[model samples]
Target: MTPISKKLSWVAAVGLLASGCAETPKELVDARAAYKRVSTGPAAKTNPVQVADAKRSLDQAEEACFSCWDTSAGRDKAYVALRKAEYADALSRNAMAGKDLEAGDVQLASLQKEYLSGVNARVAAENAAAAAALGTLGKTQAQLDADRAAAAAAQARAQAALDKIRGKLTQDERGTVITLPGALLFPTGKGNLTAGGKRNLDPLMEFLRTDPRKILIEGFTDSTGKAAFNQKLSQDRADTVMNDMIKYGNIPADKISAQGMGSQNPIGDNKTAEGRQLNRRVEIILLKPTN
Candidate 1:
């Protein structure tokens, strides 16, 4: 055998000989799958916060890789890259759920906690190194203070802009569909879009038209009534929004599509009045990528 081949075979034999009884580690397998999924999965609904979160995780994962310190092997931070990408996809779905989606509780909570922990760990490590480098004039301290101030200002502006966009659905957010508050959209036990609801949606239609993109208007209702009847009512409501888009927004008929998802995906607890309200909603989905 070639010298390198013999060395690799010896290494593999030693690794196996030193191991304890082994089955596949579920965590490792699951994590690897998630990583691959994020790298390859089709674009689904997502939002800015989720997008940012995913990217942060990915960056962290990449940085964690010891192999990344090397220039050859054509390798990236494989594990870290995977985790961050999938985490971002998860975040997108979580934000779309708003206050209603219970399924996102575990993932969203875990992500926030992990992110904070990672940030604290990184800062502590960096601060220790920086402290060791302090010179006689304390110029390093001054520079750090200035950097903090600039970062804080930038963060404030970013947060404000995010808040503005949160109330409205961006194309990324629509990938994770969540029913909006039914109470806000219509009266109790009614399928009709109230005048106030129509007024509120006026700005949304305008937003859609600004980009000349196709929209899918979906209507959903609670499961309190007959399924067949609710389906038709939901369709009718979706039609109402399409009519508004055509008449008021001047969007073309072919550019918009409408459907009803009556009682199929309740975003919140249907047992409570508030939850029921959260369940009934008109979702505006984008058919094509938008700015």
Candidate 2:
């Protein structure tokens, strides 16, 4: 061997031995312990990606130990690897927590949307029901109004027909009244119906038979006669008229009544013939219908 080459080889071997004798830094020991804990512990199964990253860092640190030969540079590498390994584990846990929180938020949003839809559907149903009820009420009210109008029109026709047939009518609190002179129904001082009276009453009797209205026959006499005689005569006259109406008109007996108001509510003075004639009268009162 050449003298220069041999001397260079001997000097390099001595320098390598001196470097090997240097003490390893405490940071390297701690770095190795940290790497072992992460790779072989629970983190290896649960956090495989993080554990792999930690193993790479540990490999780099061990390579630095051989390259730098226990110098501070080697310890620095181990320290960096330990920090990186811890960060990987913590980052993986935080990511799992974030994913769980995101899923929870999505589920809560879906539930809220479903609840709002139910509320809206319920409100719509209630509104529809209320509208249908209101429509029914309106229809009922319209029917009632139509019925009332028809009834009023019928009553007006009845009044017009009665006035045309029975002469002018006067309405009072009691009922509608038709007044007739005593000469039209009976002879002077007589309770019997005259032939002309019977003929005149034929149309009225037919009306009574058709319509079946309630009736009240009232008789009055002039004050010229004795009070007792006039009362009896008036009563007999009213009874005769009622009996004739029931027989000729085929009127129900239960629908008619008779009364005598002799010398009471006189229409005129008893001293004059005209006034006395006016005072002697028979009245027919028509009662209101039940329905």
Index of the highest-TM-score prediction: 2
> Which residue pairs in model 1 clash with each other?
45-175, 45-176, 46-172, 46-173, 54-88, 58-84, 61-80, 182-277
What's the TM for model 1? 0.39
List the global CA lDDT of all models. Answer: 0.62, 0.77
Q: Cα RMSD (Å) per model?
A: 43.9, 9.2
Write the residue-wise lDDT of candidate 1 on 71-127 in tens digits: 222123434445556666676555556645665787889999999999999999998
Q: What is the lDDT of residue 290 in candidate 2?
A: 63
Superposed by TM-score, candidate 1 places the C-alpha of residue 208 at a distance from the truth, in angstroms, of: 0.8
Colliding residue pairs in candidate 2? none
Indicate the residue-level lDDT of 121 in model 1.
Answer: 96
Candidate 1 C-alpha error for residue 160, in Å: 11
Lowest lDDT 10-mer window, candidate 2?
Answer: 159-168
TM-score per prediction, in order, is 0.39, 0.51
